[model samples]
Target chain A: MDIKEFVAQSIGQWRSQRSAHHLAFGHFEAIRSEIAIEVVADHDPAVIELCKAHDIDPGSAVAPFRMRWEGQSDWDEEEEVKGTCILVPVPDPGQANRGKLLRDRGYAETMAAAGDYYLTADGTFVLTTAYDRAAAEEKIWFINPNVRCRVSLIKTSAGSGVVTASFSSEIRQEIRQEIRQAS
Target chain B: MDIKEFVAQSIGQWRSQRSAHHLAFGHFEAIRSEIAIEVVADHDPAVIELCKAHDIDPGSAVAPFRMRWEGQSDWDEEEEVKGTCILVPVPDPGQANRGKLLRDRGYAETMAAAGDYYLTADGTFVLTTAYDRAAAEEKIWFINPNVRCRVSLIKTSAGSGVVTASFSSEIRQEIRQEIRQAS
Candidate 1:
């Protein structure tokens, strides 16, 4: 399944299983414009209580890991991620027994209300791109929080699965340094 | 008309109207993917002469102005784009002209061939928004890259009218910069 599908099911299961609370974007529009959320004292209580409620360890639940690209890495093995890089903790999607915990705590109702919420491999929030340009032979897609991808899609047979994942052979250069770092 | 209608007509009259260069991207598949061009070098003489040959005055041509958002801005004006803002530039229909110019000069048939071919805004670039949360809604509906935008299409009791010509919104934020710059 594509990203949106993973959110509605997989993301929720992980959140509750880890006994963590998060502010869900749900199906909030993240296409062209933006809206911001701040993490402040107000957010601490919910997070702390959730941490305490769950017997699972919280320290190792999330951390930043750099993705190594193919070929010689531009970075030294311990280089501090050249340029700017963003690191945020993400609850693992592979959480154990997350579903039952949600049900027992009556969080199922809340989870159901939140259309769906999944994170990418690097904890990036995502949404599909929209809009097209015939003159440019281009299709545009969207990911949340300061990211938009304008790439080309190839029509190749991927066995028999009806999936549409695009690649940017002509990607003209540089996404966010943070994302580039993470990617 | 809206972006689609504007694009079709621009393609029809691009060369006739002296637009020496153009670029565009259409919905390539079921999944919306975008392929766009970026100028690796803006001062290439052969390419610039071709631009001039098409009556595409590099000075008045919509290139620099259109790509303003995609490149770095020096915070000349200190207005902040609140929240998790993401800027996605719509592929203007004018990309066709850029390709045609290259073809006329036999510089390159497709951007892939030239390696140096870049996207210069032929007309207006539109920015659409999908909110992740809520805030003031200010959207710029500019379109038609190869030529100038008369007025964006607006439906009213008096049939329809073009949107007023407004330059691209001037606010630039550091965190929400374009992944690619036209330079």
Candidate 2:
């Protein structure tokens, strides 16, 4: 699938179980989270603002979407982790499988970041983002329509060392209201 | 499961489909291979040689095994790709989930190499090896007893840039002789 189709297939509620290794601290953490991905209209205010922030034409964006997640980690049970981010994909005019991705919230850090994304021959999405304090590389692939897997790495700012590595398996959970409405 | 149990459960035959992205070359390759993993006794010559090469006592090694693979890649259909490697795991006395792995053939380069290995809390095997020209990081986890997935990255010698990234899905193919013997 291409970028647009990948984003389309990813719209839904998902339950993700993640296992992470913090190499720098020699610690391992497990987390369970609920994630929601939804498409945002091209003319949405958020989309326009994100485009402005990145100095891109909102009209050039394709398959813009937002992702939100809430979860608990074993490292800190009392603390609930959550965030929301808008993602805007701007495909390369010359290359069909590669493009730049604008993110309002970065993966390795909580900042606006732009990353390079490309799809492998098997349709796995590979993304690499560089932040102020660190760089991150992530790969996401679907095992089936309802199941997917993600692996991510958080590296040092210079990208010489990996501080954290994680693997997550996400299973789609159909929204009850949507099912009811469809029925 | 601990390292020993993981190795035990991995015995048998497997069919693997791999997709790799060579970043430096900007090329994608697909490979189909049949893998066979078999247990090697502590006294086996190959196991002993591998342990000796790493300056480790053969008696200290746990669950030494041999892996053999034969495959063809899309990039070169006529050039058959195959290799055999013997792996010896020397577990840390203090940590049950971490150890040093000695391999007769390295992943990124075909040279004897030693790597650090650890199992995440969820039983994902992670390994990092430093080679002469590149470094490699690999993670392997089982979705179930019959299926497993592996992701690997080959990076620059200093590990700043990823030169190649690959993901492989393997399905267990029980040998007919093994089934007959069990029955």
Which candidate gets the maximum DockQ versus the true structure? 2
Leading candidate by lDDT: 2
> Per-prediction TM-score, please?
0.19, 0.53
Which one wins on TM-score?
2
By summed lDDT, the worst window of 10 consecutive residues in model 2 chain B runs over: B174-183
**Cα lDDT tens digits for candidate 2, B1-183:** 789988988888997666665533334566778999999898999888888887888888999999999998878999998999999999988778899999999888889999999887657788999999999988787655765668887767877555566666665765323323443
What's the DockQ of model 2?
0.03
Model 1, span B24-95: residue lDDT tens: 121111111111223323454544554565555543223211111122112322442221111111222455
lDDT of 1 by residue, A36-154 (tens): 21222313444334444555343432322111212111123333321211122334456421111111111112121111223333232332211221111122222222222322221
Give the C-alpha interface root-mean-square deviation per candidate: 22.3, 18.8
For residue B183, model 1's alpha carbon misses the true position, in angstroms, by 48
lDDT of candidate 2? 0.78
| List of clashing residue pairs for candidate 2 | none
- Which 10-residue window in model 2 chain A sums to the lowest lDDT? A174-183
- lDDT at residue B136 of model 2 (Cα atoms): 92
